[model samples]
Target: MPILTPEERIGQVLAGRYRLESVLGQGGMGFVMGGKHELTGRSVAVKLLLPSYGAEAEIIGRFFQEAKAAASLNHPNVVDVLDMQIDDGEAFLVLELLDGQPLTDLLEERGKLPPEELFPILMPVMDALAAAHEHGIVHRDLKPDNIFISKDLRGRVTPKVLDFGIAKLTEGDSSVETRTGGLLGTPHYMSPEQAQGHKNVGPSTDIWSMGVLIYECLTGDRAFQADSVPALLLQICTFDPIPLADRAPELHPAITQVVHKALARELPDRYASMEDFGGALFAACREAGVVLPATLEELFPQHRPTIAPGELSAPPPPASEPEPEPVPAPLAKKPASKIVPMLSAVAVLLLVGIGAGLYLATRPTPTPPPVAIAANTPEPTPEAAPETPPEPPPETPPEPAPPQDVTHRVISEPAGAEVVLDREVIGEAPLAVTRPGDVASLEITLRLRGHVEQTISVTEESPEEVVVTLPRRRSGHRVDPVGAPALAPR
Candidate 1:
């Protein structure tokens, strides 16, 4: 099979309905084009695989698998795959036409973004990934270029996740097309395991890529920076990234923590799922005081409206429109005075009869006295009882004393340092005295860079004040502490 000219390729059939319009994008395996259905006149985006790609059994299997996987997912955030077919020795996929620019284009235009601006866009992307993961799909290639942001007429941004070409489906019994040694994803966004060409990439791999994308969005620089692909891969696998604080001081510590955890070289350290990743990202945004957009769908919508080539006219009115029925008037009322007098007369007669019946019922007959024999028996029992003495009253037990409340003030080396109490972080230091019994236990943890963690506990009788001095760690030097910080009530 030979490569078709640009014009010849535009005449392909997709699902035996859509006719390709013009080339939209060109890639190694296929090209996407603006297309329209001939019968229904619905517009769509058609992706056609080149003849060379279709000749490879593995590539063809992967393409159809992507279509099948995408078809199973029906989410607003994910691009819809309408149909897939092989025509004239070329494979084609009919998709919903999206009206938006790729996230890569936006990022290229704007070097970096604040948390406020970035999270709203990133959230929907995460949502799409979450949906895919739920369906047993892992989007192995999650670069910015695969995220499309479409704007509506009102300028609302809607983010739609696209291109599941390299997605891994966990549920299906079918094997993956690529072998262990072949590289399938872009280097910059690939996970450490992915960069190593591991065949068993999972959801964690997607999380790592998302972290890299987020890091790039926030700092205008990739987390793993190296001169070559091999160097970048090595960095991803072995190097610990510089903390966001060191490179981007404007970013908050909480925000850096989330990104750092996401970018962790170890898979176990990253967020467990896309939902968890999204939640942490939003939390970071809030910690930084960054507000997100109203709705993600506002960023992208189907661009091509359904319209015939020559039929431009008004749509028909709705078929059903019912009129409301009229309400009835109220009826006239009867005279209340006549009705009340008759009812009161009946009530008086009834009460008189009831009182007479009660008097008759209360009248009772007289009773006779006990026999002489019974009185003698009672007298004999009384004489026998006189010999026994009354028992002493039982002794009362003493009551327990009330617990005394002891109060103690907490004092740190730095007078006004922030404090964490029982895992709940309280406001800045110089905290007032705390009474024992107020809480189950009082454990104070102080956080200061380069300093060993300082913890102090407090109880009723042993309430004490603490003087915490943070020690500075020398650069490139490690410290072996004598013991873990102990909790002592003061």
Candidate 2:
């Protein structure tokens, strides 16, 4: 057998699609190469398995298995697989070209991470896990080496997950999603069930691993440490990791609660879903006053119960009716003397009324005289029409459009700046922001990641269109301007 030298590997085209440019890296499974598409000229990363590993049935199966697993997912955080093939008995998969370092290498260079530092890096991974779990997929091996951190077109930090070879497709009748388990995952991050080689390893195992990873990120030390892999597995199976607060006293105490809940040994005691675990961790971070990107808000959407459009709210309880006011007792009967006097007056009045009527009826009736008619009545002339009043002279000439407010197109030199008017976000640049009608001038603020925040006042003197150059923010100085979010995270 002959060794595959770097010179022989470079400059070769694969499947008439990707042309190898250079070797990016090498791992136990295979070596990855930087390649470009021959037709579209798009940059790509090509991972080819060594013939020695390809010769083994299990290694070869996992290589092709990675293709199928990654191909099944369609998420921003998961690496995109462009093509997969077997050439001359060696298997290789083509993936999207990533422009950043792996999380493992990053942790090595920069030891422990703080809340503000860890938030943006961990959020996308949580979102990716949530998305995968939604589709009955769980990444059994989720360590730092598998996570990649990169930046997007807007200079926003992005975290992507790579290598889904050992990922378990969890869709079956068993309560535990997986039945094929033999101490899967690294010893330091594996759950008790996984360490014991139980066939019923489920999503909680992933949650447990994430908790261990979080602790490591915060302390730069593994939760469980031992001299040998076997001893480490024994500790993970029996003992609980030390509290995070004890390890890093400066860290927020709320995170300790999150770590405890997520790393609970029992499935029922642990977080039920990935969304729950991730949301709790971020929520704890927020409470501890950590500076997190605004995009983290989307991770925990309010679960509003589904109601039909025509459904109506229950009617208010019927108002209680007031009882009728009690009537006063009738006054005592009037005296008999007063009653008799009244009766006498009534009789005399009735007799006088009868006599007057009789006299009027006896006096005879007089006859009305008859009218005489002329042979022909002359026609009367028609009346003249009434005149209409004149409308007031045309209202004072036309009035001009009100100058109460004006709109200015706000733009940044590098563009995509989040615009704020009087502390309220209007939109992202290049966008039009109108000054409020009540205020003559407004404090317009423009903010972008990796750029200094600029707040200026827009008055009648300000130009209709304005552009401000934003200086790049130096490393270790994360900017969180008050306005809108510059990036929409996965």
Candidate 3:
């Protein structure tokens, strides 16, 4: 069969239903065409595997893998794979038509985006990744080009993840490794393990890629860059990128921390899952004063637990109490007196006769003699008042002196070299180290592989940045060998 040009292929009907309208986009493996369903009259996008790649088993598998992986996902931020079919030896997948453009185009248009604008686009993307992670799917290749920003029917911004051609399913024996030509993922976006060509990569790989995407979106530059793929891979594997805050100084430190955590060199140091990454990203954006277009619930929908038949009944109504009988009032008590009233008149006469007989029997008693009193004991003199010592005046603490602004910028001829301060390794070169301003001077040591170590003392009056140019190390020979030239530092 003769190959048809893209223009000639336009209007061609696939699967007897989707009619190709125009070429929407094209990539190395396939072409995405604008199409319409003839029977339903609904617009859609058709992804066709390139004719040249159709016969290759791996390419064909990936093409179908994209459909299978995407179709399994049901998220507002993930592209919907509607139908897939093979016609005339070419495989195609029908997807929901997106109105807007890819995130790469947006980044090209706007050099760098502010957090307020960037977070809205990325939060949903993170949510979609979180969902994919829950389903045990890893988008091995995640970058701006694979992210699409569209406007829904209500004109709200919706960012959708596209092209799961290289997605890795983490279940059973169905996992497909796409490490072709010794490289599995994009060098700039790959984590250290992925860049080093590790066989087992999980959700943390995607998290690292998302961190790179966020760094790019904020700084309009790649997190890692090199002139060649090998150099880029080496950097990803062994070197640290410049801090996000240094690249985008206006960004909040919390935002920088979030990105840094995602891009940690070690897997253990990185975010464990996309959910953690999304939570941290949302919190950082919120703390940075960037208002997201959606709330956390909208970004991360909570899974409602399944309720059984008897689980969701309304609480029984409170029991009503019976009315109590009225309390009876107590009667007033009579006043008591020492003498009884006329009721006891007979008893009183008997008591008075007894008292008169006692008074008649009692006669006059004899008086007792008085004793002599002792004389004069000297009066005790008043004790002298002890003196109260005055308390020493409260000493006023000396006022603390203001701290000095001791910020030193360290730069090396070849940037990204290791910087050591006071025998302790600080961050990489081309970074600012703020020490206690009270120090008279800071001893900074710069070290790079294949270069001689250089040390410099930075004082308060020193220039803003201490620039050090290190000489290349020269190898020493115990004995001169034939054809060996003299060694000298470069």
TM-score winner: 2
Question: Per-residue lDDT for 22-88 in model 2, tens only?
Answer: 9888654467899887877888888876665567666666656645655565666778666677656
Candidate 1 TM-score, true structure as reference: 0.56
Which stretches of candidate 1 lie above 4 Å from their native place?
11-16, 165-183, 293-490
Please list all clashing residue pairs in model 2, or write none if there are none: none
lDDT (tens digit, per residue) of candidate 3 on 1-490: 8887677899889878779999887765568889888877888888876677678766666567655766666566778677777676677777889988899999999999999888778877887777677766788789998899998677877788988634452111222224333333456787777766577778898899999999999999998999988788788888778998788899999899999899888889998788778877777776777776433433433321233212222333334855678976653444445345755887989999999989878967668679665688578999999999999999999999898777778777556789987688888989897767766566678888745677776666566866666543322113211122322211
- Decoy 3 TM-score against native: 0.59
Candidate 1, residue 401: how far the Cα is off, in Å = 57
Q: What ordering of candidates by lDDT runs from best to worst?
A: 3, 2, 1
Residue 142, candidate 2: alpha-carbon lDDT: 82
- Higher-TM-score candidate among 1 and 2? 2
Per-candidate TM equals 0.56, 0.61, 0.59
Clashes of 1: 12
Point out the higher-scoring one by TM-score: 1 or 3.
3
Reference-based lDDT, residue 260, model 1? 86
**Which candidate, 2 or 3, has the higher TM-score?**
2
Any runs in candidate 3 off by more than 4 Å, and if so which? 165-185, 298-490
lDDT of 1 by residue, 361-399 (tens): 898855878756654454344444555677889989889
